[model samples]
Every structure is written in structure tokens, then in C-alpha cells.
Target: MQASQASSRLGQSRTSIGTPAAPRAERFRLTGPSVRLDPRIYAVRKDIADIALADRVFAPHYAEAEQARVAVPSVALREGPSDDARAVSQLLFGEGFAVIDSEGGWAWGYGLHDHYVGYLPAAVLGDMGAEPDHVVRAASALVFADADIKSPVVATLPMGSRFAATAEGAFLRAENGFIHSRHAGAIAAAEQDVVAVAERLLGQPYRWGGRGGDGVDCSGLVQTAFALCGLAVPRDTDQQAEAIGEEIADGAALRRGDLIFFPGHVGLMADGETLVHANAHWMAVVREPLADVIARLQPEHEKPVLSRRRVLP
Candidate 1:
């Protein structure tokens, strides 16, 4: 009999092989802020698996993972483990990440502050140390090897970078070097007027993935301002719209510190009637009457305001 005919006959006889063939392998979906995977029942990538049992691999839960601190001035979090990969976000100095796994010269992990996951160059990370006592508040601040401002600059810290410090007469001593005290603020301190932080970046050119003083995006402005105030927020508009704070039911209720979200943009409420944002429209950070912004963008976006989230309250 042909193989197909023989299989048909075997199917008719219920009882058969030494043991019933095992059920088809099952796959479970695993997701995080920056990755998604369908891991099979018996096999899981080391980067996504938490532990390996005798016959199966377990997904990473991040419950007791090791932590590392970003030691460089800034590092790019890329989508893949390569230098040419697209950068999804940037980590300022002193930001922390939960080390999930390491491969080649990259570390796959999640940001401790925003829970953003991606790969960071391994050389930029360091063992966790004392918590930061002060944060660099200037758009960019220069660190000197000595307290003297004339000394050769050591490192240029981006706004929102934090470090352990002790105040000298006019400078703050950090592990790397001495930074002018005026450029630093107590870590526990928060800017009550978040809008004021946004105002300082008035002419900064807009960049799609920028998060520093020289250039920034809409969500970057909001994120950097909040960071100066010791509040942790995510990097993108969608995440910010959903996760930052409570929603305001009325548009008139919007106030300073309230984050206004549009289709794919975000801005901070400067006052009862003003909105401030790093906009590509203006190609720079600008403040405008809330009503004007609403009227102009509403027609284009099909709606003026998507939602208003009160991040402070």
C-alpha cells in the first residue's frame, strides 16, 4: 500500500505508535516597552528568557535583576545590537538601567526611570554607586578637572544629568570632576514652575530624536523639564499621553504642569492660556496663545487637543 493509504489505515486503528505524539509546541507572547517576542514552549532566546529549566526556558520577569548606571555623558538606546541601529531614546548621565543580558559590546536592558527597554553600548555603563545628590540644571554644563572655571573642561553634562556631589564655594564636586554650583540643583529639589524650565529652551532647534540642550523634540522638552523637577516620565508622546498623569475632564481646567497631547505631539501648559512646545512647525521651541494653537492645529489634526494630563497633581 502507498504511504498515504497506509497512514489512512493507521488512523482508523486508534491505538498505534509507542506513545501518542506530543502535542504541538506552544508559543507564548512576551512584551516589554521596546520588544515583543513569541517564545516557544521549549526554547527561548537568552536575551528574553529569565531562566532555563531541564526541558523549557522561562521568560524574563525582571523581579530581581542587577542594576547598572549610565556613566557616559549620554548614550543612545538602539532598537538592535548594532551601532547603525535606529536610536529609540537617549539616556543622560547617571540614568539607571536594569541589566537583562549582554552580547557582543551591547547590553540589553530597561531604563529604571521610564522602563524603556533597548540595547546600550556596554562601555558606557558602570556599577551602581551612591545615589545622586544634585542634578545638572543648565541646558549643558561644563565640568572642570579643578574647581577653577579656567581649568581644562572635563565633561559637558547635558541637562537633567544627575550625580553625587558636595558643594564647594561655587562648584559641585562629582566623581568625574567639579561642575559650577550654579549649574547644579539639589537632587531632592524640584522646579515648581515646570514651564519656566521650558522657557529657557526658547530658541533651541527641534530635532526628531533630540533630548539635549542643543536640540530637542516635543516630548523631550516635557521629559527634560520634569526630570529637572525630579519627576520621571516616558520618552514618547503616546507613552506620555497614557502614563504621565491623571486626565483633566475639561479643557478649561488646563494649567501649568499639565501636559497637552495631540495626535503625535505634546506640550506643556505654560499658563491658563499659553502652550509651550518644541515644534517642528516653528522649528524651535515656542510659546503661543492656547486658543491660537488650538485653532491652527485643530484643522490640521482634526482635533485641537486630544487630552490634558495633570502631571503634577
Candidate 2:
């Protein structure tokens, strides 16, 4: 909707599959003001935009987003349409992509799961299939050509990736390959502990904008952890800092699963005094004393803690 027209629909809200209700007008207000629309989450370019935003923004053309799904195990969503461009995020197997446009072998769209907008190679997207029925529960699950353990591996699906499958003895028969039933679980199943899921990625390489088990960043780690627990959250640190659970007093004591934000960064509280994160300092996912993290980051950012939030009851 147009920026000026969105105010009237402020009370209207819609929920995505398996996610909480979010007011559409509220999102427009957050990213709709002609000058305020964030390209990172809104598919608006100088020439064209997603038809959904036609009311709020001006463009020579507004196109309907064609539905597509990630066909590869994982594909980088880059800042630009080239492989050399900085990767802004990743689209994992079976995750939906709303293709607003495609050109020069790249598809420009937003990930339906996170609303992260970027350019993914057109080859990585394919027809949207049946809704995913299973999710990889392990750090990474190998997809084999056949149900046999010795079968040739066809793909390596990251944790949190979803797919449709049918039980076949000890395996789940997917369209492309067979996955060990033990490595996957019903998509609707949710782990009770988000921190536990984060801990599983311990020692994983730290990569900016990477969210898979192979590599991940601070906010990516947080988002992945929450996602495995069946919770939906914004993809970036600043957004998480603002939209996540209620904030605590500056010096309030923290507990497990609490989110501690630092300027341009965030980490999960492993305990009252410990923090777990995919950090650049270590170049890997690691856990350390909260005091130590504060000491190391203080000189650079000044503020030791930006905000502390508790997400779990």
C-alpha cells in the first residue's frame, strides 16, 4: 500500500504459515515512507517494485512476485547479481522466494521465510513444490541417491532446511534423494530450547551473512537458533534488537536464552554469565564469559551492552 494510504490499514494484520501475526500496515510504516523504505527487506528499485508496495511507493512499473523455491542445498543472496558481490544472506533448500524480477541469470526477490531481499542466481530457484513436511534436525543431513547407507550422496542439507518426504523403512524418500529418517523430523516439531540448538553449531566457521551449519554470523546464529525452535524473527541484528522479546533494565540479571545486544552485534546468553555467538574474534561459533565479551568489545563500541532481552518464558 502507498505510504499515505497505509495508515488506514494499520489495524489489519496477517500471519504467514507457522508464524505469528504481523500487521501489514505496520510493516509498510516501518519500511514504506518514500525515503524510509529499506531495500534490504522491500523489493523496490528505481524502475520497478513488488506490486504489494505500489500503494506506498512510486515506480514506473510494479510487478507481481512469482513464487519459487530454493532448489539447491543453499544459495547465496548477494548484494548484486554477480558471484563477486557481497552475500547478504542465504536461501536454503525448499525455502520460498518471491521472484519480483530476474535478469542476466540472477533472480531479485525476497526470501519468503525471512523477507530478506537480494539477488540469488536464477539457477538456484525452481518451481514451488508441495509444502515442506520435514526439516533436517542434525547439523547437516546428507541426501543420498538411495535409502542404502552406502548410496551416493546427492546433497548436503543444512540444519533447518525443510522438504517434503515419505517414510521408507529407515529413510525418508524425497523427490531428489533419500534422507536418513533419524536426521529429520516433522516440520511442525519445535525444540524447547533455542540455546541448545545454537550450541549444536559450536565450532562452526563464522562468515558474514552466512546462516547455515557450514558458516554463520552473530545474527544469523540467533535467527537460525530461533528458527529451529519454530520461532520466526527478523534476519538482521538491528531488527532483532527492536522486534524481539521485551527489554530488561540495563543491569538486569540475565538467564539462559536471553539475547544480549551489542552495537552491530548480538549473542545468546548460555547462562547468567556466559555468552554464545558466532564471532569474528574467534572466527567461529564459541562460548565465552559475558564479562570477557564486554571487555573485548568495550574499546571499539563504547557501550558494553545495547539491550538485553528475554525471549523464552
Candidate 3:
């Protein structure tokens, strides 16, 4: 089945951003020419002989041989090599991956961004090349085939998509199209106001495994916001809770850019009293009083806050 058709069949419903889907072990087993290996661990085809095994993630069954770049605006990273599998995450345009194995039109590999392992349509990948020079900062930006604004839009790049570019009059000459200079910034640009970046996604609907303006989950919201500022964070809540910035001993001390964690959710501190998140409760990105959110969740979660970390500090 095609990736798009499979995604439609699985249904893109709102899901808890805090919880990842069931372990790959419980999903499906690899068979035939593909050796059964832990889905979390990277693996390649069983017959390939010219394999590089320097990386710990590469073994007899797993080898690092093929590399590819994302060729679409966004592609699903699924639990299995089939389109019917649950989407665990998404690969934005221009993202790179190491192809460890293949099954027909599906490629199982590890995402270079967060080192996430999953399956994406082999058709959406291309040969890797030079690293991107700029990242799309807008929620979504139109890419024109020419520098003229009147020109037809060739593609729409979601926030966080990277591409090589050079100044061309009032636009930047990108690999696929011309982008307005105002919509993109240097990949190494200094971190800016994360709150402001998140506010742009205020009305975007919440989606499971979504990280762009189309839809976004709590951690995806936080991750996307910070990523625009050139900061990197884990993709899931539990890992984020353990790996991100310094922990604040007191919730009262929380300030802007601080991350607040709940039992299975997360939100960014807009200020001392305001919280911004892509919450299922709202079915969209919304800002609410921190106290009200804590009070509402306390009954069901049994705890108001799990941990507070200052990502900016």
C-alpha cells in the first residue's frame, strides 16, 4: 500500500504526546530476507556483504550502508515497514536518514535529527548532500520557483525544514525554490523568544506524531518552538523530562521558557502564571493560567507537577 493511503487508514487522531506507541516488539516481526532484530535497534538487509560495522548500532544483521534525504514536505515515520503501522513521528523536508534496511517501497532507518528509528516510504527519500544553510522560521512558508512574489508557489515548507540557500536579490535561492528572505534564517541563528515562536501555532490543531503547523502534540510543540531557536530536545515527554535543562526545585520559581511536566503531558511556561501547550483538552494550542491547569489535572493525575526544568537557563 502507498504511504498516504496507509496513513488515512490508520487515522490521524489526537493522541497523548507524552506516551509513545507500544514497543516495536509488540507490533510486528521482521521475516523473509529481513532478519528479526529489535526495531529500536537499527538493522539492514541480511544479504548485504560490504557493510560498515563501526557504529555500535550496526551489527551482523544491522549495517550502515545506504543514506537518504527527505524529499517531501513531511513523511511519516511508522512503527513497521507497512503504511498500516502507527506513525511514531514525522520527517520534514530536507532531513537526512541512514537507511539500514528496505522492504519494497519502505525504508527502515534512523532519523539524523533525534536519532529516531522508524520506517518511511522509500520513494520520499533521495541521495544525501551538503547540510542545509537555513531553516524555515515561519509556521509555513511558500516557496516560489522564481524571485517574483507573483510567481507560482512550487512548494510549502513547514517550520523547521532546512535547505541550502544563498541571497538572491530579495529572496534566498533554495534547492527546490526561491524563499522570501524574511521567512527564513541562518541555521546557526541564536535562540530567540520561544514563547513568541510557540504563539504562532496558537490555533493549530493537536495531532499525534505531528511536529509542524498542520498538527502538533505537546512535546512536539515544545520541540518545534525550541528547534527554531537552534536548541535540540528529545521527541517524547519521558525522555524530555529526564534529558532537558536544569531542574527547578520549586514550581513557584518557574518562569518563561521553563518546561512543566505532568503525569503524561508537558507545557511551556509562557510566564510565571501562563502555560502554553498543544493540549487534547483544548484540541488545539492554547494558553491558560498555570494554576487552573494544575488544579484541573491534579484530580486525575494525582500530582500537579512532575518536574520543572529551565531550558533557557
The most accurate candidate by lDDT is 2
Candidate 2, residue 61: how far the Cα is off, in Å: 1.2
The residue ranges of model 3 lying beyond 4 angstroms of the native Cα positions read 1-60
- The clash count for each model shown is 0, 5, 1
Q: What digit string (tens of lDDT, one per residue) describes model 3 on residues 1-313?
A: 1111111111121112123433321111222242344344334334321133222222233233466899888888888888799987888888888776677888877788786778888999988877788888888889998999999999998888889999999899987889998888888884589999998888899888888837888988888888888888878888799888988875357788989999888999898889999999988999999999989987888677889988786
Estimate the TM-score of every prediction: 0.77, 0.88, 0.81
C-alpha lDDT (0 to 100) for residue 128 of candidate 3 = 82
lDDT of 2 by residue, 46-75 (tens): 777776775667665555678899988888
State each model's CA lDDT, in order.
0.73, 0.84, 0.75
Q: Could you tell me how far off, in angstroms, the CA of residue 77 lies in candidate 1 after the best superposition?
A: 1.1
Over the full model, what C-alpha lDDT does candidate 3 score relative to the true structure? 0.75
Best by TM-score: 2
Model 1 global lDDT (CA atoms, 0 to 1):
0.73
When summed lDDT is taken over every stretch of 10 residues in candidate 1, the lowest stretch is 1-10
**What is the clash count of model 1?**
0
Query: Which residue pairs show backbone clashes in model 3?
Result: 44-100
lDDT of 1 at 135: 87
